[model samples]
Target: MKESITRYQFISLIILFEFGSSIIVGLGFEAKQNAWLFILLSMAGGLILYGLFTRFVSFYPDTPFPQVIQILAGPVIGYILVWGYILYFLYISARVLRDFTILISQTILHETPLFAVSLLFMIVVGFACYLGIEVIARSGELFLPYVLLMGGLFLMFVFIMDLPKIERLEPFFNIGVKELLSLVFPRGVSFPFGELIVFAVIFPHLEHPLNSFRYGVIGILISGIILLIISVTILMVLGPTIAMNSTVPLLDTISLVNIQGIIQRMDPIVIIIMVVTGFFKITIFFYGGVTMLQYLFKLPRRKSKGLIGFIGLLVMTVSMLISENIAEHLKEGLEIVPLYVHVPMQMIVPSLLLLLLFIRKRKIQKK
Candidate 1:
């Protein structure tokens, strides 16, 4: 927790986190051709939300979020809010761990047990969190460039191989305007974008606190572009019906890539990117959760290792038992998570904090 990350390193983590499981999870599954549109709209909203978070963090630099929350809302209420956010981080880590495990099983590790895959993955994540934020952010610096390269190569192959179809985007807003905007609120805003809530914990740790707004907005924008390209590629290659139906739309899109009948199977690159980015995402959330726990519960430094183990074990168990199948997990993530957990906590809660902060500052000025 004493270590800090550079602005570019922070941006790298954001890019990886935003892309995380979403690469294959498929967006706007219902929006179909309009998925990329929602990503754009939601990302705009996300930057605005990140702006609000920047304002909030600007109130207190060099302090952790749990303490800040406690000061803002008072002991009882702030503690509850802090706990909820930590739980949110932990739950999200579990879900992503579950997602990567399943994807690995389906694509390359058919014979590997889901438990084994998740356990091994969590072990590395646990060790990273065990080391501290600097280690995790440094790992992002190491892995993200290669991930970006894979993506660029993937795009080159897709275009050179003639896979994307322009006509698939026809009959725009097929679901009508009202429904399209509706998707932007909870599902679109809550995910890839709303997940910026974790950065609240991260921002205070930056080497330059004043640079948070800059790094945060730019990071969200870059990740948004990546998500847009991925969603568009899927829509163009697979069309609406297949995109909505395919468990992993990006993978399906890559499967269609054929460079002069030579480079047909390019799914492995997607998997590699997923695993690398997914590690950063999970480790970040884990770090967020552990840091918050240590701050809120007053765990001694000597007991910090115990705290890490408890968190890792709990997330592993929750991930394994969370669902009976991938279909159920997708349904819950799309329907349940955004509506109940994401909107109130991720969107409304932070907005309220800013409102309260504004009022408190004004009252102090008047005195």
Candidate 2:
């Protein structure tokens, strides 16, 4: 297991992890009409949560979150907490893989079998995981900047094509503050930002543990800003009505770009961006799950490769079995499950662990 990953590599993985899932189909649910505003508010809220999660890590710089939980909550409670997180990571990875396959089928290769596409994606991700964290991290470093730059350039083209309308964003707060705040919780805030909880496991592996909090917060902020931009871009170009109705708002908006008809059909660029970012996101989740399992079970380092492969296969199978259609899959992902399952794991559990840690510290001081 290669232990040394550069700062840039780590930063890229963090960025990819945050941006990957949201950028792909987030607009689908966000509904471009006011999606951008939701994104902005979500980012602000996400940053606050990111700060709290980072603070938790910073407080116990030398210990991984699992160990911190164990010390604070006792072995039984801590093990359950760790297991919950592990399950969360695995579920997220499976959902992402499912989402990616759905996108590919809908957009790029409509004729390809879902199983084939899913299998190929899992194979690549499994190989990357097998190569260890350093390889995955470096690959992120190499690809993420290009992905971001390309996405920016694509949006710039959309703007230049005269597709965006400032007036489309008019009638602001049309949903009222109550509805807007409600939108932020399940759709905007929890999904992307709360997902950063996975970083708790990876935090201790950083070359400089103390710096993890700084870089992690910065990474989340940057990803949020980009997501905000994407939301705004989609809203402006597609208009609220069309954007709200479209399944892939960003891709649909890209399809509308017509630079004298010669530069038309640039939706493929969106596909490229999706694929690259999706790959990075899944890889990081896979690595996080594998690492946590190994640490929890005291498995040998060399065993992670096989374990990751098994996990990938399991995810691929689960992705196929989980939902009957994309709509149902997304309904669960964006609506029902995030609030009930993810919020507790990502936000509530960590807060509980932090409180326990504080109490323990006071107890030790008194002794």
Candidate 3:
């Protein structure tokens, strides 16, 4: 039987996945005190991109993403494109895994090798993948509340300590409209929202596929609001200069919480957020790639441990080998990947696909 998930599960996954790496890295630092504006703008951009995705999925609710590609683009070209997405998804999976392991190494695991942390992390994520998307959805549902509660608690502590000074957000429009618009595009939107492209594979599994769009919209808005609050909090607490300069802005923001020094060092809260959201993010991409490969070769859903194992190993290796160090990894992610990889995959391709779909629909209606 094909695995399916409820509408609630679907919403949970989207929220958790959106929260993924976005929380850890922070967004729109270029705008400084006005970083919140960037996230708010990017939320709109994310909704537009998401509308494209859910619209595409709606065209073929029951079909796998690869098959939809073949139907839309023809067999040969679609086969090649499907392979491209498989590689893209796997590459992104590796990138996010690297993101998490780097955080671990920098924080608590200072003495441990990154390779060891990554290996262990990948093993758990890979196991979850092997169990299937149903497992992933269920896990997301189970963990969503815990993640939200911890996040809320952290915020409460920050406020209790009176760390956030609303005055720090003075001179909100530090940059002009044109300059601020540039900061939100491609990079700001790409990191978290554009990454939702991978969910094309999972949308087909929703029990009520027609409602996927509504769930997705709600999920993004909820997560976006949460992120907006956090981003503003970071800015207000740390001030624009320090928040902009900090590597992990959220971590730094949380570390400052001190209730008479007794409730100090809330770094673990950030760590938990990273580990949970990172797992969801990486595993979704990993599953997308693995699922695409399975569909391409017409493999049976059951008894695919061998393929999962091989792909898991590949993801683990690529995570470590992708960059020389955290600096290089972040540099590639911030500077290089957004324009070249993200813009093409997340923006251009989807726009073209939607255009073609429109043309095809018109032709059929004329007949």
Candidate 4:
């Protein structure tokens, strides 16, 4: 059976995927006292980069990056590029799995074995992948609206808890233009913005390839705005120092909501939202990894699913090995190595591919 997913479903997955990992806790650390400002700046830059990427995709409608590289750079060079991307995707999927497992163990199920949590997540995600992209996209579509609504309610409650402090957001540029710029455009035009590179892999699967640009841009914008609002809420409610120090600022903030003691202890609801959002996010990375492997080795049609599951199990194991402490993982991920690893992968390589494609197109026209 030829299964298909609509463009909206894909868009929802992308949105949820981006929001999953760091939207709540990431700002708690990196952005700190000026979390909202940092997010706004990051979003603005992210949108610009995303626009550039989408334009590149639209330039060659239905052609994924791997194919584009092959045509422009020739098979030898293209295969190398594809191989690098495959490895990158595998690494990212592993890291995200580990991070999510850590969160669940620390907060919700303290008694659960880490391996058990990782295995259960793999089983569920593996099943989704086995069902194919269409099934995964449908799940994203079904859950996205509800997740958004729940997120909205959470924000509303945050506002109710601390309305007066909303003004604390004023004096917007007080963090110094340099610091703000650093947070937004860190490491010379790279950072989180470069993450839009994954769209290149999935472009062929988009229902409306032409409109992928629009939808992709919209997805980043929506997610960015939500992140900005979330950062602001956490800052106003928890204050700068505490919010920065908190492992789960949103959860901490939610725990403070009393509503006459009846509506208290809503942290569980936030955890539910985390699980849902994280699932979609991790699935996208996992899908990207699997697809890359299939394309790289030219695996048999049906065997790709089984192979991908085995690969995912390895990824989970690697995640466990990467760190003994959550703080160390965050330190390495944020401060030590992301700029070095992600920047070249996300920005440098793709930009080179685009350039090569343009040069090849010119040569063909000249002939």
Which has the greatest TM-score?
3
Q: Write the per-residue lDDT of candidate 2 for residues 51-124, one digit (tens) a residue.
A: 76767666687676677778777899888877887778888888899889999998878999999999999999
lDDT of 4 at 279: 82
* Least well predicted 10-residue stretch by lDDT in candidate 4: 185-194
| Error in Å for residue 284 of model 3 | 0.5
**Model with the higher lDDT, candidate 3 or 4:** 3
TM-score of 4: 0.93
lDDT of 4 by residue, 1-367 (tens): 4445688887887788777777545552354566666766676666776766776666677775677767767899888888888778777777778778988998888999889999989888877876778888889899999889888888887667663285555555567777667666553234445566776767777777778778877787787777777777777777777777787778888888877667778887788888888887677777777777776687753777769778878888988898888889876767655577777787677778778868877988999
TM-scores for all candidates? Answer: 0.96, 0.94, 0.98, 0.93
The better-scoring model by lDDT among 1 and 2 is 1
- Candidate 1 C-alpha lDDT tens digits along 48-85: 87887788767787778888788788899998999898
Winner of 2 and 4 under lDDT: 2
Residue pairs with colliding backbones in model 2 are: none
- Shift in Å, residue 271, candidate 3: 0.7
A best-first ranking of the candidates according to their TM-score comes to 3, 1, 2, 4
- Candidate 3 residue runs with Cα over 4 Å from true position: none
